[model samples]
Structures are given as structure tokens and as C-alpha cells.
Target: MTKAAGPSRRSERSRVAILRAALELCREQGFGGVTIEKIAARAGVGKPTIYRWWSSKHAVILDAFMEHIATELSFPETGDHLEDLRGWLHSVARVLAESSMGPLIAGVVGAAQYDPALAAEFHQRVYLPTRQTTIARIRRIQDEGRLPDLSPDTLADLITGPIWFRLLVAGDPPGPDYVDTVLAAVASQRFPASAGGEALQ
Candidate 1:
């Protein structure tokens, strides 16, 4: 049993080392420059070791990138759901504006245009979980009659589209007022001044 445990632990350690090395390499050199050979060399493992766990270097990079983001991201609940949603939006904007993950995410977005497998894997592994969670939250608000009767998908797009636009299209930093403006635009159809003011509480 101890002999079996020894190899299992070593494999786990090597997996972590490879992911850490991959993230650093991708950040330093970008995805085009990252390769399995380089990651294995940096991780102190052979190419076969990496291939044993992941099908390709891109898979390894995706896992590493997703892992880092998951650790840093969260949706805090303050029991007031609307306030919580606003806070969640603020937190997301802050992450993109303040973290190194932003460029990495942009790289993946660009890469996905040319790589279908990477796009699918990224959507399944990274995007869908966050999207689904946010949608469920929005559905709850809709049920409360505080929001217009939009589908959760549309609601999510309304909330996230501007944030993505600022990052990807305009290259503008997410200013402090951006979240408020977005919230107000969505809230105006029903709640009016309460969204940007104090009446909601």
C-alpha cells in the first residue's frame, strides 16, 4: 500500500508542478510559444508524463488557467439578492481590471476562434459553470418582480456584455461607475431610482 501511495503522491505533485509551469510560461510567452516539450522541461518531467494526464499542451494550459481563476473568483451572498448581484458584478469587473488573468483570458478568446476543441473545452470547463450560477441568481430576482421578465440568458448578457465590451472592444478599464450604469439600465424598466439609489433595501 505504501509503495502504491508513493507513486500516486509523486504523480499528483508532478501534475501541480506542470500546471504552475504552464501558467508562467503562457503568461511570459503567450500560447503560441507554449509547447509540451517546454512545459515538461520546465516541470522537470518527461513529455510522456504530461501526455499521461492531458491530451495536449492546450489542455494543460486550459486547466491551469481555469484553476487560477476559480481560486480568485467568487459570488458573495449578503442575503439581499439584488445587492449581492450588484456586488458580484463589481467583483467580476474588479478581477478583470486588476488581475493578470485578463490578458490570459483574451488570449484564450482569440485562440478559440481558430481552435474548436479548445473553445468547447473552455466553455465546458470554465464559462458554463459561472454563467449557470449567475443565471440562477437572476431568475430568482425575476421571480421577485424586481426585474423585467427576461430569460436568464438575456439577463446575463445584459449584465455581462458591457463588461466584456470594455475589456475586449474598447480596451477601457472598468471604471467605478460602469457597474452602477449597467445596473441602472437594467433596473430602470421596473425599479427606477432604487437601483442607483437607496430605496431597494
Candidate 2:
């Protein structure tokens, strides 16, 4: 069993090294400058080794980016859901404002605009999973009666859309104040129950 596990452990180590190298190169050279050759060289692996795991540069970088996000941006599940949401949003703002991951994400989003294959892969591998997770969290908060009975999907968009806009379009980093403002807006937009059922007033 130990003999069988040796190659698996080595494979896992190689995969981690490759992902880390890809992210580091992205920080140093920007996403457009990253290539399979560069990643292989930085990772101390062969081109065939990278190609064995990922089909393209975009795929490799996307996986790396996803891993980084998974490590850094988990929604906290404290009993005070509102505070948890606030903390998570603040964490996102900090990352967008202060980390190399910000520009890397912006580069991927910009590239996806013109590359259909990359866009599709991004939507499938990144956007959908993230969106689903956000919606689920919103739904849970609503169930706990801390949030309004708004559509979780719409709530998810409302919570995250401004941050993306600031990062991608406004050319500005979202700050803690911006996060607080968003939370205030969310808290203020309460849909009160009526005879006609809960409707936006």
C-alpha cells in the first residue's frame, strides 16, 4: 500500500507546485503573459506534464485561481448571519484591493469576453459554483429570518455586483466603507409582508 501511495503523493505534490507556479507567474507577468512553457519551467516540470493535467493555459490558471479562492474566501457560518455576511464581504473587498489575485481575476474576466471557450469554461467551472454557493448562503440567512424574503439569486447579485463593478469597470478597489454601504442597502431593502403576499414596495 505504501508503494502504491508513493506515485500518488508525488503526483499531488507536482500538481500543487504547478498551481502555485501558475499563480506566481500571473502575479508577476499578468495572465496574458502566462503560457504552458513558462508554467512548466517555473514548476520544474515538463510541458507534457502540464498538458497531461490541463488542456490549456486558461484551464491551468482557472484551476489555480479557483484553488486560491477556495482557500481564502469561504463564507463564515456564525450564528449572527448578518455579521458573517459582513465579514465575508469585507474579506472580499480586502482581497480585491490588496492581493495579486485581483488583477489575475480581472485578466481572466477580460480575456473571457473575447474567447468563447474560455468564457464557457469559466462560467461552468467558476461562476456557477460561486453563484450557487452565494445563493445557498443567502437562502440560509433568509430561513433564519435575518434577511428579507428576497429572491436569493437576486440577493446574490445585489451583494456581489457592485464589488465586481468597482473592480472591473470603475477601476477602483472596493473598501470596507463600500462593503458597509452594501450591507446597509441590503438591510434597508426589507420587503414587508402584505395581503397580496411579500411584494417589493
Regions of candidate 1 where Cα sits further than 4 Å from its true position: 1-5, 190-201
After superposition on all C-alphas, the RMSD of every candidate to the true structure, in Å, is: 6.0, 4.4
> Taking the candidates one at a time, how many backbone clashes does each contain?
0, 0
The worst-scoring run of ten residues by lDDT in candidate 1 lies at 192-201
Against the reference, the lDDT scores of all candidates come to 0.79, 0.83
Clashing pairs in 1: none
What TM-score would you give candidate 2 relative to the actual structure?
A: 0.84
How close is every model to the real structure, measured as TM-score?
0.85, 0.84
Predict model 2's lDDT versus the native: 0.83
Model 1 over residues 61-142: C-alpha lDDT tens digits? 9989877766556777777777778888877787778656677777777888888988888888778888888887887787
